[model samples]
Target: MKINRNFDNLVPSYLFAEIASRTAAYVKAHPDNRLIRMGIGDVTLPLPPIAVEALRRGADELGVKETFKGYPEYEGYDFVREAVAGYYRSFGVTVAADEVFISDGAKSDTGNIGDIFGADNTVLVTDPVYPVYVDANIMAGRKIVYAPCLKENDFLAMPDKSLSPDMIYLCSPNNPTGAAYSAEQLRAWVDYANEHDAVILYDAAYEAFITDGSPRSIFAIEGARTCAIEFCSLSKTAGFTGTRCGYTVIPKELVRDGHSLRDLWYRRQATKFNGVSYPVQCAAAAVFSEEGLRQVHENLAYYQENARVISAALDEMGIYYTGGKNSPYIWLECPNGLGSWEFFDLLLNEAQVVGTPGEGFGAQGEGYLRLTSFNSRENTVEAVQRIKKLLSSSV
Candidate 1:
């Protein structure tokens, strides 16, 4: 038998390895240039005090024989699910506690959710997308298709009248490019999905980072429950990156061909996965606490400031960009018509600031760039300054 052939065509290793090689070469040649990375979208903050206290208390409970939690229920611990359900309510969305499947992060849930779907489904994604969605569908052997999301569209991806797909992926306050869909836009897509009996895998990992009046949940749109599964994470919401906890909401009302996706997902979880650790889950639960909400929103405000800084810099340079007001990423048009990688090299070599090239995201990302606000405030300011200098010199 042949080894899984899909592995042979995978492209990330080559792409990221090339990024590493180029970054390494730059560092070697310019050792004195201090690089401030705004790539990879990693969290720089520590766990909040509330989460920390809960984590410590949870560990202490585990130390007692009576409170030790062994193998977690595949669906997840009730307390964590209840807390997540409550968290949903805060946004005016209703998700049942039993419908919540706690996992490590949104990325894992986004990729692994493909295990339950049929291989023959047509998958639709934004042109310049988060990459995980398309790659996951490809690995699952689905017929993948794309929709262009460019400057004219404000980089908000939507459905086309020309196609109907069985599965769709959407990231609001999107990852690499940081574009968010308006409620009206999402409603239209929901309408399309409902018309076609398709499933929309809604990713809201960066929803907590949105500052504008944009809806934070897909459920904000009417009729989403009939055709949507939303994945949310505490990683961006509450600095739980290393802490490892996220949840997927499967509505019981989501039925197709007399089959319940909620039940299928329950079976899938029970067969292949054990739940997240109790202490870490307890920490995630704490993220819903009153104190935790205040602290985390403060952190998000700080990150929003970083986005403000980057977007302001872009404006001063007269560069066109999307996604600063609502999300922590600034998608910019590459000046001088430089190719994405060439622009990446120019920024790396001249400015000593690292940002993700838009092409790495997808084909429609060919002439753009993505810089994140996940860096420290100091670094964000410094990087913007460096960008100004580089653009001034180049132009």
Candidate 2:
């Protein structure tokens, strides 16, 4: 009859939920208003042709008993695992097929991976991080402490060598803030985790969206395999938002108390998950194919253009913002001294557009706002135009 106490301390469902509810109410009352949303980071593109064909082929295989795969090898299809390993190698990061654990989504893996370690472990996480990282540790009853990732830090959290935590969570091309860590900054974290015998949970889900030369994978840093686990997802990369396919890289070299993390994650997946559907795995594998990679890049290029459009608009008006150069998100300074939510409301009421309020992310996110470049090209251009008008009028 007792519910977990951590549930009591947890904040309400994400900020997007409230935004949806508010927008829904307004639409119900004023059906004439056309709401152009730049809030949720979900991709609005279709799966590429190569991936689509792969999915269809997979479905055909399922139709024939000769190829109908039942209860996939808990680790996932070997073809897919090999493809992932190839990806790491191509990027100058070494990983083995056995080190890759396929999952339904990064959101789920980030939460379920907690089962591997004891609850007493200290979790050092960043403030204003992807909520899943922080919330999961608390749910597991772990000791959670946050290292501030404020504007002063350029939102790239660093290691506190003086206080080593058992586990650390880091996200690059960060959600909400859109800040990507430099190579040196990432190496410092890798060294710290290795020195302290700690693990760094590196979320590089947005790597495919990175346009400029940036370390797309944490494994780019030396000694990362000794101290880090990397998470990547296809949702943003190839428009799989609803398709839901992601992978976690558990290096064979990483160990704690003489137990292998790679082996542990394998066991965890075997017990709890039936790999992604046969069709999904096949589709994901095809993503590495020459044609698949080509088609996917096309979609990526389109979204990156949207980022440029939004960022350029902000720049022309002399508004300060970060991202667009390397990621699909643009973090803008809310006008004047308005609180994030206050600015959110102002945009919705005056401009008929909606953006995410950074304050809803965490305490450090106050006075900031987030806008995603995931809308249709036409809509994205229109949204930028409307925002510029609102800004000029307000100023």
Candidate 3:
């Protein structure tokens, strides 16, 4: 039997995997090096106390016969969905509880959602995007197109009316570039999708990090409900990276080819998926509670401070960059005209620090690098100083 030969077209190794391999080799050779890793967006903070307590309560409930749960609903529990709905309302966006589907995380939903659409549909994604968006579509053997997110546009790629794609992927406060789109800019994309009869897959995983007045949810834009499906995660928001819980919102009004996209997603999940753990959903629901929000924001504030420190150092170095204002990432141009991987190596060897090479994201990411604020405050401070000294020495 023949395999899905499309797999043959993918790159030999994933971006992060290659980074790990190189770092591993370095550590093996230099045993005394104290490496400070600022790569990979994984959070280093502990889960919020409120969520942890909720998790314990939910788990305790399972011990008694009355509260013992068998299998969970594919679309998640009513309480969790209601909490998510209330969260939308707080931000002045209305969302019905019935429309939310609880999942493992945004990463899973984003990669798996493509299963509902036709294989023949064309996919469009921004260049220098999170690799999952592009790689997943490649596995489906779909014809993929790239919208260049160049330096001139501040890394925000706009819709090109000339190209017609059946599906589009957009991440605000974008992954590698850390640039977000304004409401007026997003309106253009929503209108374009409606006109082209195309569906927009919007990733709002980093929405909570937004400090400015940018729209936190695509539903904040008018006409979006008719064309967009939003995926959000607690991984970055509430430090649920290891906890594994998030939600996907599909509007009932989003009908394509005369089929309710929401209904289609429901059917897809019910058939192939078992749903998130009851304890995790309970914890996720608490994330929207008053106390829960306060605790999570405390952790977020710490990361924001780390971002501020890094940004200040870059300012001193006179580096060209974006983000670290409303985002937890700093996307900077490699110093002294160094290429992406070249800078990655320089930081690793000279500064004993690590960051993602922008080239790993896509072609447009060349000569760029991405740094995260997910590490401890002390580590963040030290890493920036190390970077500063290394760059200064070269000059």
Candidate 4:
């Protein structure tokens, strides 16, 4: 039996794995040096208290006969789905509870969503994207196209009408680069998708960090219901990265190739997935509650402050960058024309700080590096100080 030959096409080493390997080697040799990691986008905050209490309460119910839950609905329970819907409503976007599918996280759903589509479909993604989008499609042996996200466009790739793709992947407050799309910009994409009869897979995992009314959900655009399926996660929103809960919104109105994409996804989930745990769903629902929102927002604010500090340092250094205002990432150009990995090594060797090399994301990311604001405030401050000292002296 032949294995899927497509697997051979993927890079031998994952981006983060390579980062970890190099960092590990450095630490192994220099045991006394303290390394401050601003590399991975993993959140450092604890789950909100309300969510913890809800999770505990749900777990307790499992002990009693009357309240015990055996299995969850594949589409997620009505209450949690409603909570997700309410979240959209809070941002002035309307989403039906029936349209939401609870899942492990955005990363899983984004990768798995390709299962419902045919392998013949061409996938269009922004260069310098979250690796999952590209790798998943590659695994399916789909023809992949890259839309370059360059500095001229502030790292937001707009659609070109000339080429048509069956599936499109977009991320706002984008991973790696951290650039968010404006409403007008999203409208352009929505119109393009509808015009081309393509499905846009929009990732809104960092929507909680959007402070400036930048259309948190693609559904906020008028034509998006016909063309966009949005994936979001509570990982960053409520510090649920370890807890693993997220949702996918497929509009019931989105019917493609004479099939309802929403129904197709429901069928896909029912067959391959058992559903998220009842306790996790309980905790997820709590994230939308008043107190829960307040608490999570406090944690989000801390990260935002970290972004501010990093951005301020970059500004003082007269460095060109994007993100940090509406995102937890700072995508800065490599100093002195250094390549992505070159800068990554410099930061690690001199400053004892770690960041992701932008080239790992995609070809367009070659001369950049991605730094995250997911570290502690004290650590963030200290790390930036180290970076400032190193860059100032080197220059």
Clash count of each predicted structure: 0, 0, 0, 0
Q: Which candidate number maximizes lDDT?
A: 4
Report the lDDT tens digits of candidate 3 across residue range 1-395: 99998889788899999999989989998999999999999999999998999999999999889999979999999999999999999999999999999999999999999989999999999999999998898899999999999989999999997899999999997897889999999999999999999999999999998988999999999999999999999999999999999999999999999899999999999998999999999999999999999999999999999999999999999999998987789999998999999999999988889999999999999999999999999999999999998988999
Report the C-alpha lDDT of model 1 over 1-395, residue by residue, as the tens digit. Answer: 77767755567464456777888888898888899987667788788889999999989999999988798888888988999899889988888998899998898989988888888889998888877887777777788889888888888877898998998999998866788888899999999999999999999998987766788999888999999999999988888888888999999989977889989888888888888888888888888988889989988888889999999889988999998888878889999999888899888988988878889888889989888888999999999999999889988
RMSD of each: 1.3, 1.2, 0.7, 0.7
For candidate 3, report its TM-score: 0.99
Flag regions of model 1 displaced more than 4 Å.
12-17
Worst 10 residues of 1 by lDDT: 7-16
All candidates: TM-score: 0.97, 0.97, 0.99, 0.99
- Candidate 1 TM-score to native: 0.97
lDDT of all the models against the reference? 0.87, 0.86, 0.94, 0.95
Position 297, candidate 1: lDDT? 92
1 or 4, which is superior by TM-score?
Answer: 4
Q: How would you order the candidates by lDDT, starting with the best?
A: 4, 3, 1, 2
How many times do residue backbones clash in model 2? 0
Tell me how candidate 1 scores on lDDT: 0.87
The Cα RMSD of model 2 versus the native structure comes to 1.2
- How many pairs of residues collide in model 3? 0
